[model samples]
Target: MAGALLGALLLLELLGGGDGKNEELRLYHHLFDNYDPERRPVKEPEDTVTVTLKVTLTNLISLNEKEETLTTSVWIGVDWQDYRLNFSKDDFGGIETLRVPSELVWLPEIVLENNIDGQFGVAYDANVLVYEGGYLSWLPPAIYRSSCAVEVTYFPFDWQNCSLVFRSQTYNAGEVEFVFGVDEEGETISNIDIDTEAYTENGEWAIDFCPGLIHHHGGSADDPGGIDVVYTLIIRRKPLFYTINIIVPCVLISGLVLLAYFLPAQAGGQKCTVSINVLLAQTVFLFLIAQKTPETSLSVPMLGRYLIFVMVVATIIVVNCVIVLNLSLRTPTTHAASPRLRHVLLELLPRLLGSRAPPEPPRAASPPRRASSVGLLLRAEELILKKPRSELVFEGQRHRHGPWTAALCQSLGAAAPEVRCCVDAVNFVAESTRDQEASGEEVSDWVRMGKALDNVCFWAALVLFGVGSSLIFLGGYFNQVPELPYPPCM
Candidate 1:
């Protein structure tokens, strides 16, 4: 008897649950039996349907600077009143909410207006939530690719203001009104809502501000007005990636240009080579920057301008290298050093450049009289005295005085001519030696002038490089992101 009673109670409970489910099915059919999804669920045709739009930012997918597009993932919450879907809860087991297919109800046909790929609607057809008080809410997830104009003036350290515009495609401003959603405290929110728990942070970008604004377009004779909600997402680039990969390398390479000037002028080949390499590196960096930014002629990036400045400096260094090399290889025979050039390069400039002048060549010494010539004369005199009277006879005539008398006259007259010839030979050799020495000294002075010019150029390049680099990069170092993405209305 106890088992039979228990079985009977269980059967009755199952039957009662089945009847409740049947009533719920009857409610679904009753709501959609005469419902026309194409018609707006309003009592009057002129009545405006106010839609409250709220966005839950899920992820910042990517921002393509080259294409000027922003791809994001968000959940669009759209809420409005629908008089046709309303019901009395007491007639259907007190059901307060029902989840029904979104196709069986009227939709606002809201879409992304500034989409780049022409895909405007939500990604999924998700169910609609209907309440007993004729209120409908739809939360659909969408991946939007919206157009965002990029301002690369301070790129890699710049912040961008990108917007996602939403509007009703099938309704005009007179028939639809857009409003921002309210928070739990009933205050209208002006900014995009971030779901911290579900939001995934982007690697290269950081969110700064995301404000939503409602705009009303007034109708004209030919154009119909519409209501739109604009959600502006302001994001700043992380900068770490670009700084490490592009900026740091470029700075280090530009420093090499200064080192090229520091090198001695004798190494003109090496100096020119270094400058050319730096120029090539800047070219490569410019190409890399171009790839990352859009192709626009309105403004050049700060980094690009810096690269161009460095290239210009490098080109100047290369030209200076040619001048230094030409001066180095100059010779007095080929290119004479003028009086003014000599004074500047060898005298005044050398002193200013902290260099010493080339030493003057030593004067050639006068040749000493040969003792052998004197010995030759003395030997001739002795030989004349020893000679017979006949051998010493002059013009075959005997001397009336003595043998020594004739020999003395003969030796004096003949030896005087030989001594004159020896003196003339010595004088000629001395003059030739002095002339060679002077030529050598002139050649050395020209070489000294080349070195002096090199010193002057080195210091000049150093100063110019220092000043140019400081001016170019200082502005970037002090660059700061603005507090607001756009200017506030006056």
Candidate 2:
């Protein structure tokens, strides 16, 4: 009798515990038995369901300026009152909150309207939290790739105002109302909330501000189009990456352009080589900037403009180098230095540029008076011919050697014409040599002028580079991001 009584009490305890455990299962059946998930959880058909929305940014994936897209990781919190899901906690064994699959309930179905990809909904269909008093909250994580207009006016030093527009596809403004989520203080939140603890910072871009606003479009009593929530994510480029990789290197290379003019006129090849290299470097930088920016003809980036200026200067330097080389290599035979050009490049320009023409080579000293071989030969011939044959005699002998004297006179006279011809040839050669030396002096003047011109050009290029660089980049230096993410009227 005692064993039977103990067994009966134990069975009763087990039955009670089992019943308590099945309460959640029974609640699920009771709540969803007649629940029409298709119908809006409103009392009347005309009654509007207001959904509160809040976005928590998890990470900034990337912003593609060329593609005009913004990719981000975010969590969207949507809360609303679902009257059909209400339940009595006391009847369900003190259960207050229940988690149910999102497919079993009505959803606001807010989707990104400005999506670059064709897909519109969130990334996943998550669970919904149901409270006893008909309050439902759903937090879905999504990776949104939305369209954003990129303004590359400032470029790497630029700030952008991108937006994520969310709207309901099934419901119009009259059927569904959208409102911003409020904080614990009951104040409406105007900006996106950053998940600071979980947020990963972007290396290239920094968040300036992100403002959320509710905008209604084409909604009237007869025709209600829709309402959208615009989350404007204003971001400014960090600029450090571009400054190190693009801007600084470009500036240093552009500074090398001025060195071309400082090179001597004789080093024209070196000057041309440097100018071409600088131009090519600027072209490469321009190409890089083009790849980074959108392909638009509306405006050019500041850095690109500066690069173009540098290239133009480099081209001019190359042309000037050619001219300087031509001047240095000029000869009196081919290109004579005109009096005006000589005065400007050698005299006037040099004085104005605080320079002087190179000194001419010293003239060679005249040799001491000496008789030429031809002249000596001709003098000996004339002295022999001047004396008569009868008087011709050796100093040691006193005989009138008429026949031998006649023979010597004949030989000397015969060689006289050949000696005279040699003398005339020597005089002609001397005159030609003197003319060549004078021509060489004239050639030296042109080279000096070329050197003086190089000085003038060096200073001119320096001034132009300084002023042009300052003008082109000064605006970017002063560019400042606005405090507000978007315009106040927006």
Candidate 3:
């Protein structure tokens, strides 16, 4: 520190004398004043400059699937040899290095065209360190908000390819250009050491492959192309979270929809409510799926498509419940069973399904003596009503009212035959009641129709539920197998 202070005092004294004999200070002034501002850092007027770049990805900012935008931060070191910026060793007290304003020397005008406009991060050639041998290297770090087209055909289990395209703006192919360095002195660049170890792995995404290279593409009508540095980033979804939280729940809900069919038609109202809830659950999952994937309709996500399919099947189940309830509640007086329905559902379908109706309850036996007397009485009454008085009232009355009433009728008949007519009238009344009781034993057509409908629909629903869920869930399982390939399906 004392030696540097003494050297500063000596330089100040020389500058105070105004004779301009200070070698170090004068060398700095002379170099800056005498430098040609128009000259480039090249040996020949048209000699191209070759730039070598090394990069490191620091962090990921955001990836917008719907808008297809990716924002990240990176650090790049650019190296190039400059002849115009070199200085003689003997000029300034044998100084071997000099740090000066970067604008004082020529710098490459390479820019990343894929970067989003109006949101570029601050960057500048802040300080340029020039060595005595004309070696110029600049290390600048920037947060690049680049956007790329996103393909989300297999979302939640999907992988996307995005790129950072670097190009030149100020210098074109006509004047200054760029060339990519394949190796450092014929040694391959280490791509695996791109600062990935410290990367903050996103909760929803994982890096598949990050390969960067330089390639010169031909010019187009819009702009002349010279050189481009493309850093390809392939990222795939981390689907464990979605599979457990979203996909599994959705699948279980779909299974519930299939089970809704098992609820008896007697619970049709409850079954309809359950089916509606399944639809609502699917709707919620569908919304979540839309949030996870891009807006393109090129293809549907496996989970989203599955949810939609289950929703459709659930709607059909709702309709089936309505039909079952309607059939089960029909009344014989208002709605009789159609012949076609009876043949198809009651007879044909039951035989096809190998099903049988529930047995009716046992009935009490009629009194044998009463039944025989009634049968004889009915014959007498029927004969009396059709064939005048051919049958004797005393004979039929004895069976229906017993021998006491017959004897009373026979004694009364001696006075007047019309008086015995009372016994015949009682027989007629009993016969009418027998017919009404017989009709009550037969099952009503409406009840039989309803039971037939319930059995048929129950078996039919079983088949549909099995087939529908098997096909749909199996398709989803195979489609979402992450290890099938880089791009499994579109």
| Predicted candidate 1 versus true structure: per-residue lDDT over 1-490, tens digit per residue | 3245335545656677576665566676668768888998778977888888898899999999889999999999999999888898998988888777787788899999999998999999888998897799999999999999999887767888899899998999877888888999998876788878889999998887888899878778665588889988888889899889998999899878878756665678998899998999999999999888899998788889888887887898789888877776666568877899888888899888777875656969978856644554555576666854324333122134345754665665355665445556676788989988777777667656666876777788778767876876676666665677544211
- Model 1: which ten-residue window has the lowest total lDDT? 389-398
Residues 31-140, candidate 3: write the lDDT tens digits: 55556545666667667777666666777667888777887777766678876556776765676666555556666766778876554433554566667767777767
**lDDT of all predictions:** 0.79, 0.82, 0.66
Best by lDDT: 2
In model 3, where is the ten-residue run with the lowest total lDDT?
481-490
Q: Write out the backbone clash pairs for model 1.
A: none
Model 1 has an lDDT value of: 0.79
lDDT tens digits, residues 145-255, model 2? 999888887777788889999999999988899999889999887688886788999998888788899999997778987899999898888988898999899999999
Off by over 4 Å in 1: 1-20, 220-224, 346-444, 477-479, 485-490
